[model samples]
Target chain A: MRRPMPVLAAGQVHEVHGEGDDRAAGLAFALGLGTANRQGAVLVVRGALRQGLGLYGEGLARLGIDPARLLLVEARDAAALLRAGLEGARCPGLALVLLESEGPLKGYDLTASRRFVLAAERTQTPLVLLRHAARPQPSAAHTRWQVASAPSLPLEAPPGAQVRPPGLPMIAVEALRWRGGPAGQTWHLQWDEQHGGFRDTTGSLGGTPNRNENARTAPSGAVLPMAALRTG
Target chain B: MAVERDAARHGLAPGMTLADARARCPDLATLPHDPAADAALLTHLAKAMHALTPSVTPDPPDGLLLDISGCAHFFGSEAKMVAKATEITGLSTIHALAGNPAAARALARHGTPAQRRAEDVAALPVSALDLGEAATTALRRAGLKRLGDLVTRPAPTLAARFGEGLVLRLRQVMGDVAAPLAPQPVQAPIRAEARFAEPIARTDDVLEVAEDLLRQVAAQMEQRRLGGRHFALTLHRSDGARRRLLVETGQPTRDPPLVVRLLRERIDSLADPIDPGFGFDAITLSVKRADPLDARQTGLDQSEETQDSLQALIDRLGVRLGQDAVLRLAPADRHMPEAAQVSLPAAELNSSVSFHLPAMPRPLLLFDPPQGIEVIAGVPDGPPLRLRWRGAVHEVIHAEGPERIAPEWWRQRGGHMGEGATRTTRDYYRIEDARGRRLWVFRRGLYDGMENAPSWYVHGLFP
Candidate 1:
């Protein structure tokens, strides 16, 4: 049986978590949601440290997000990040606010999360809290998602080529908690740069029987059975 | 060796030797001269004179020149303006008004009351020309002691006897030619100030005064069709201490409430809060920079309102955080990854250049200095098979071609063939690891048999 794709509602707080090496994927997913909404400008607030490198404008444009409409605020610490996030959430002109921080964000407790939710709801602006290298905790978020990188589909190569290049970016997104809807659903989505949104590729990967063995060993593929049990 | 009135009565005067002045007046008291202190006093007096007119020029040493031709009516007459200036400076001054700067300067310094009141330049002494002692003595010895004797003579004859400088000085003092005066550059009078009978220490009362002053300034700006981009509020304490608050906006604005809001944010974010020590006795608001802004209609359209709110948000963030903390990304026209884009403060960025999307895919995040990695390639010049980065080994699952990028020779010193040259060619590759983490790695230098082996670096990460 086919199931409909779940969508995050606006005017609420959502959380996205990416462990250790998968932090970039979490940031990319958050940016995808921001660009797909296409309201006003997007404000991205992050701490100074643990950002490995900085955001590249050309790379942002390649992801179909306009660099001109992006405002980057680098805070000195998590507290400053939360303050900037609260300010951004209060702005009604912003379509989305992305708050990124590493480690356990002590300042983002229940009170802070509820404050962000109240501000977002008042302005009808969506807020996405991106946590890197941190475990999920209880909060007033509308939904919580765990993201990990997935192998992209191979690009077309010449005849008898020894190796094929990676194609567009792909990621595995699993819903850990849903406030009003059924949770525990996993989706493998590939970024479509031309259309500037995600395309469901869960069925296409199943059709490639020759690559099934490799997929079974992948971390993204291992989460399917657990998700199935929770949904059932 | 200048003296006060009592010493002058004792027959002492300036330009006399100290020993001679002491001999002339046995009880004379003198202190060393400080030119710096004199200059500071002159500067202070000049600033004080700005209230009377905008064209007050300091004559240095001990004088000021005021151009009161059109500004005298503001004080009812020139005498009243001079009286007000004296009151403001609290100094007994000798002032005069004439047709030109040189005439006024000479009249204030040398002319007697009768000569000044009659406005008779020709009746004054020849010393009024200020052409040095040699010329004055020559004129005096030639029985032409007064300016009237020189005025009656022909110009060529006067120039021939007393030199061209004397003729020019004579003409300048007689108002025959205009003299140049360097007046201080004055800003527009978009200022409002208030003084309280009793000092107010409460922050609320201070803000109330600020609001009142802002309303007055806004009205002045509206009348001129101007908007301020920078506003400064200065509070004067009863004990002579001053506290100043400055607020800036992204666009020219005349809204008093918006300015007050920004000022409140600035106060809240201050590292050292305003103490209001001994309370504030006076408050003044001034616009430092203004731009031509016409009256704007509000609630025009949804897009306009959205833009307005966005600008307001940027301004607020800039005030709370530092101006540099809030930034916007602008594309730079360069091929190097580090120079491809620049982050600039949102308030200062007015870039109109369109961003050119790179033909090849770029990573989402780029390291400023690419991190080095240990790689074991399949061949000496081929793609990597496995790489060790940050103390971890990653097996390459998929590999792309080696897109070679040559160094920009024009930007390098020695044109790529000297000991001082630092840059080299790089071959970039898009490689995906076993865990599906794609990275942009480049091999620095070539594997040719000329130098040492080439090294690899991870330049960026892909999402």
Candidate 2:
């Protein structure tokens, strides 16, 4: 059964935590939510991390976010990241602000999160905080989500074909906390590039496991998938 | 060693050995010569001479040439202009007025002040030609000791005897031929200044004067249907120290209040606050760069207002954080992943470049140089069955093919088939592990059985 994807309200602060090596999933989820409306430019303030890679424009375009409408600010430290996030959230011209950080940020305490909430409320701008390799902490966020990568369904091929490629990018998101709604609801969603939104892909064969089921315990690892025959 | 008037009176001259000069005057004081410092001082003096004329060329070592053809009327006469130039430089100057640059340079350096007339160029010595030592000595030996003697000689004979260089120099010095003068390029001044009789020390007072000057400049820009992108406010202190404060905008703007706010932001962001050490006697505001910005009516929709607000926010943040801190992503037409996008400063992004989406799925986060990983593939050219990365092992559940991407051979150091090529072909795959963690990994080289074994690397993470 398909479940309705949780909607993140505007004019509030929301947190997304990456589980294990799923930092990219968290970032992609936040970007999907931020660029959902396609209203105005999205401001992304990123703090320094151990990883040396940066955001790629081709990937952003493929994800349905216009590269031209993306404003990026690389903060040298945590304090700068908070400052840029607060300032961006206060601006009425931006549609959304995404603050990405790694590990435990020093200055992003409850007080700083409250300031961001206030600023975002004043401007009616949605603020999405994407945290990688960080634990859940006390904050003023209206909702918090724990996100991790999920295996996608393979594309259908002819009877004689030897291989089937992966379909779309999929993720398993669990609602850790909701301000006024029921919490702890898990959903397996896949990015639909044609519609520019996430589609619920739970309970399908050869896809992700059922909701709340640890993906490591799934029984789909025994079958050996055929090698793809196409070459670039 | 250059001697002063008193030392020259005691028979000491420039270019003399220090021992000989000290023997000539035992009490003589000497200082080491610095050509770089001399050039810097000359440049400073040339900048001060801008008040006399817009066209001022610094003649190297120790000379300045000013093209005062039409600028003489600014000071009522050429003599007063020369006096003003002398006063501004605060140095002894030998000024000359002539028709051409070469004649003027020769007359100023070699001729006497009484011979400043155009016809008196002939009376100058043969050294005025400046044709180097050998040419000058040959000219003197040929009985042409003066410029008058060279001018009377036939041109063909002179060219045949002393080479074409001497004849060209003779014509240039005699003003028969014109030589192009490379003057320092100066921008048209769009500035306003206020001079106070009594120096003011208060910060508020200085800002008030600055506001007044900004208003004047804004009005001038409005008249020309233009807007300023960069503004510089210079404060001249009574003790002769000058302080400059600069502010730039993301878009052209002439609104005084907006500019004043930016100026205030610039002042506050300064590492060391502006100090009115001895008070400021004058303040000048100049528009360093101006662009044509036509007036537009506000639309009923909020789009225009939103763009204006966005620009204002960019300028504000750029002033506080730094210009480079605020950036916009622009697409680059390159095949390589890292070179596919460029981050440019927000203020300088005039046009939006759209990105063309690739046919293949690209990972959201791409490692700059793909990190190496240990892979256990089923075959040399087949997909990986298991891989270990960052001290973690993962069993591959679903794997995709080798999407081969060759290196850009045209961008190689040598020819396309060069022997010392470092970059190898890569075959990428999108793989999902047992835990459903998707990764984009690549094999470094092919298994053609002619070279070493190929290695695998994890390039990016899929969401």
Candidate 3:
């Protein structure tokens, strides 16, 4: 049995990217769920206050995650955004920090990335670098994911019209690089809006909604079923 | 070239050569004149006098003008205040009081008694007018050795002969015209001082002294129901050199320990460390800016303390790494994406200014100068079809806008007609390249000859 774990373990630097607000919201929700004790805040380094609020507030709420634990800090440039992330990591009280910056940031060189990794390790905090429109580059991050909006399974349509409100957001995520685990993994994770968490739909092309409703154990902590192992 | 009163009695006048004065009086003692050193000492003394009154201006060369209008009563009376000043200044100061600044200044230098009469100022020598040597010589050569003689002359003739300077000086000294005294930057009313019995040189000792002074200031601020937003620490060294350190907080605070820690960080990070040359004879801490500090009730969860600790961290970092080094990006009330947010010093950010995230979908990264690119478009006002940026050509697969934004006419009025001001209307577009990389592009200016031909620029990137 196998399970897809969304946990960003301590000291690991995770890189995630996608279109619009899902990247930040998905990561915050995943990281928030993994940590049993929510004593520290989840920092988001991004501008556009309303955008962050909408994504985190609505997105987290849909996943049944509390949005109050998220804190947004705006930075002037990519380098500043990285510095803010590193500073946040130095605080042992912080659970995770997400640096949402433009990809191919000019000043974020190898040395700067290494410093972030080392600082995260020292403070026992996980860091996620979310880049936009950026090409893959060598970094100290432990995992890298390329995410996109997936066509969610349509909800039961009313009679002949077949019209329905948009389904819960589903992200098609590809693991481009994984340091410790299997690389080149893919998954279509549907957000369980009412549960405030994510559900793995790797069993079938159109997995029945809430297939993992009864299996509540953390995937990394428990054994996974055979269907989830198809793509890894 | 100024001579002591005794030297003047001995016929050694100002403008007299040093050799001539020494020749006239075989036992005459002379020391080199240091104008810079004198000004510094005068400023230090004036700061010390701030303990007596807030309005103390250094009347350079060797005097301070104290405006004790309503403050004199603090020491019981004007006479007692003067007595207190003499005591504080170590009996070296000569005090005088008059109705006007010019009169008071002239009387103080001339050792004239406290009298507001115009005739009393006139009785003093013309040198008391503080006119330069050329004008003083011109007045003396005209047989007007006393201010009284100069004032008695016909006003028009005096103006014509000695120029307007002498006439103005006569009117000022006689209290006949208004003369504004530019006071030293007024010191804050809340301050604490400590004069050491023995000068201390070690860094630890200096910090201890600063901490003690901070405690006193913090207590005073507490009594007034205020917190200090800015603090200034002035250290008067044993050799008379003074060093001042200033630190500003993100929010008003009355916590002495936090204030001391911030000051220590500032001192430790100075490019040139605070050298308590020989030692520091006196140290003063002043609350340069104070704000009303209402008591905050913290919930049992201690959420407020978390905010305070975060602010304290920012303050400490700001002091150590220079205020400009630590910055926070805040929303600006401008439509231009680059101008939509501003970077402010972390220390200057207050809790009062709420930063609302802009509602519009702005790009993740904005080009600071908005780099221009060569573009091929169907129509002048349409989205870019293919653009050459940074020497590479990007084919536009899908495009989304002609979001028109006009130049602010009110800003153009009375503003320098520079490149930014002369900008015409802009049409922005959110375009996706062939590789699915999203870019925010714009066409600057219009084809209607409002500015140069419409040019293309890649303004930002969408993540």
Candidate 4:
């Protein structure tokens, strides 16, 4: 919380990546933050990977995003995906655009990203490029962040008597790059699925850290934590 | 048989034998007459006259009628315009100026070899009125050989002698009345044109002319409070070939720059680019489809401007790529997962379709044709423990549903036989795999001992 996160600007490109978990949570969070009070729809361009139906509703519900306002476009390749993204970004009725690609996106270079940035800026629609296990590449994006799923706090059960399901999922987020500001600041935040809001667990929870705690407690647990099995 | 001028002078007339003509003049020569060649030459003349005025009608057996009222001034005078028409057609043409089209046609056809006015139409032959054979015969028997002879007779007496049609024709050709002329069909398009003294063979010249024409068209549209959704540019080449390029916008627009940009894109993307061949002599642009567009007062704010820019972008893309390439998802009326939604062309989206969020979580992507899978459920009526898809097995970590959905049995065939009438009842499950991937799996058919064993399919994925 000491290093305040920069606000997502209208008509800017932001890239997000996740490690070893349902990568959708980061996209849901970005979508929720980018499309607040904008009078348009959200378009999701999912490249080659068939993003199944289950996680979207759950993730949007967790992030407090309205499913009715979301539009999904399944593209065939990187080029088509990028075109869909840039076109969606240029649409005035679109409040935000979330793009997810299967592999290293081809032809999405500095020049292409710059064109996307210009279109987004011209239309004042925010664009979020979500990737899974992709290499860091140069782009005209305003910021980039790496989001990894972190362990949630242990559920309340008699410590020596029995273990219960974990409370909520937490994430370790780092701003890898941020334009107009300093980058490389990491924060531990907890996501309230019911209310679809984020909390700074490290700032308010006295920095009780480490995702390994759940793994350590799961082996000897009677009620395995529900959050531990909430991946995918 | 048609005789040449020289042959006619040697005491020879058309329909006479060649032997007789040769006997009359030893040097007489004859050639076969082709009606098709005459028709084709007439058509060429008609097309050539199109440059002078768009309303040009063909009078068969060797004549052309042109409506040159407003356009005559362009060539300096009616006489000069006729001269230009004769030059462009490269034919021996006789033309006359009259207030009515029938008088003009008759005067040109039979009044004289050169220019004739409406007053002179009375001296022409009664046959020139183009009356029926019976009326002309009756007029000839009554010694009314000239239009003057017919006009001098009492109007009622003439009408009683020859039916009302003859009187009507007489009045029409006499310039005392008006007769509507049916010319070649011309769609009334808002258009502008540019003619070059010399033909243009370069793409830049074509684009420049197109830009000017677009400006003119846009101004006209603005004056009419209208916007054009479809535009066409016709390039008339010097070699008589016409090339046309048509561009369509996603929505009505009167912006000249946007129209020119779209035309440029269409020209650049053409697989067979324009080959000026002998160069274009004239270029014309027409607004083929227009819609009434009211003036929009946009505030000097970011949101409205952004919306305008976005609309411009969509129109540009629609011209470059196809309009179908841009799509928006619309909910369908069917209950089946695959039929529950459809992709509609964004430009032509049906706004009345209300979007309904599924009561249960539906997959973001469903297989076009649901892929079959092997399910290993531990219980007879429970979710699968493991599913094999694409030769890969996924161990189910958790399972959610047995949401039963029945087939639309009203449409089932073999209604009378219960054995054949039974349709598969689907049991959908939202399951998580060991690798943390969630899947939508469905069991088809039932194990009620009245049918075959059930099958499974992987329907969709969760993002």
Per-prediction RMSD in angstroms? 12.3, 11.3, 16.2, 15.4
Question: What are the per-residue Cα lDDT tens digits for candidate 3 across A1-232?
Answer: 5645544667778787654433443353344333434455566666322221223232233333334445556665565566567767766656667777654666666787788889889877788777766677887778877665444554454454223322445555667788766566656565553444456665454333332233222223232333321110
Judged by TM-score, which candidate is best? 1
Every candidate's lDDT: 0.81, 0.81, 0.67, 0.71
lDDT of 4 by residue, B63-118 (tens): 88888878988989877887888789764456677888888888877786533744
> Whose TM-score is higher: candidate 1's or candidate 3's?
1
User: What clash count goes with each model?
Assistant: 0, 0, 7, 7
**lDDT (Cα) of model 2:** 0.81
Per-residue lDDT tens digits of candidate 3, residues B1-463? 5677788789998788888888999999988888888888888889889899888888767778999988988999988998888877773566778778888888878745533333277688888888889888877888888887877779999888778887887788778898888888863589999998899888778778888888898888888889998999999998899999998888998888888888887787688988776899999889998999976667787666666655775676567655765555555677555665666666666632444433443554456678889999866766677899979898775566667877765677655454565466678876655444556788887686554677888776543
Range of the 10 consecutive residues with the lowest summed lDDT in candidate 2 chain A: A223-232
Candidate 2's residue-wise lDDT over A46-78, tens digit each?
886765777777888878887888888878788
Per-residue error (Å), model 1, residue B52: 12
Task: Give the per-residue lDDT digits (tens) of candidate 1, residues A121-202.
Answer: 9988889999988889988899998888878887876465467787898887777888777577667767876666676666
> In candidate 2, which residue ranges exceed 4 Å CA deviation?
A1-4, A157-164, A205-207, A210-232, B1-52, B55-66, B69-188, B192-212, B234-243, B272-284, B420-423
TM-score of each: 0.73, 0.71, 0.53, 0.59
lDDT of 1 at B112: 92
lDDT of candidate 3 at residue A4, scale 0 to 100: 52
Candidate 2 residue-wise lDDT, B253-354, digit = tens: 888888887888788778898889989999999999899988878899998888888888788778877899889988877766667778899989978889
Candidate 1 displacement at residue A64 in angstroms? 0.7
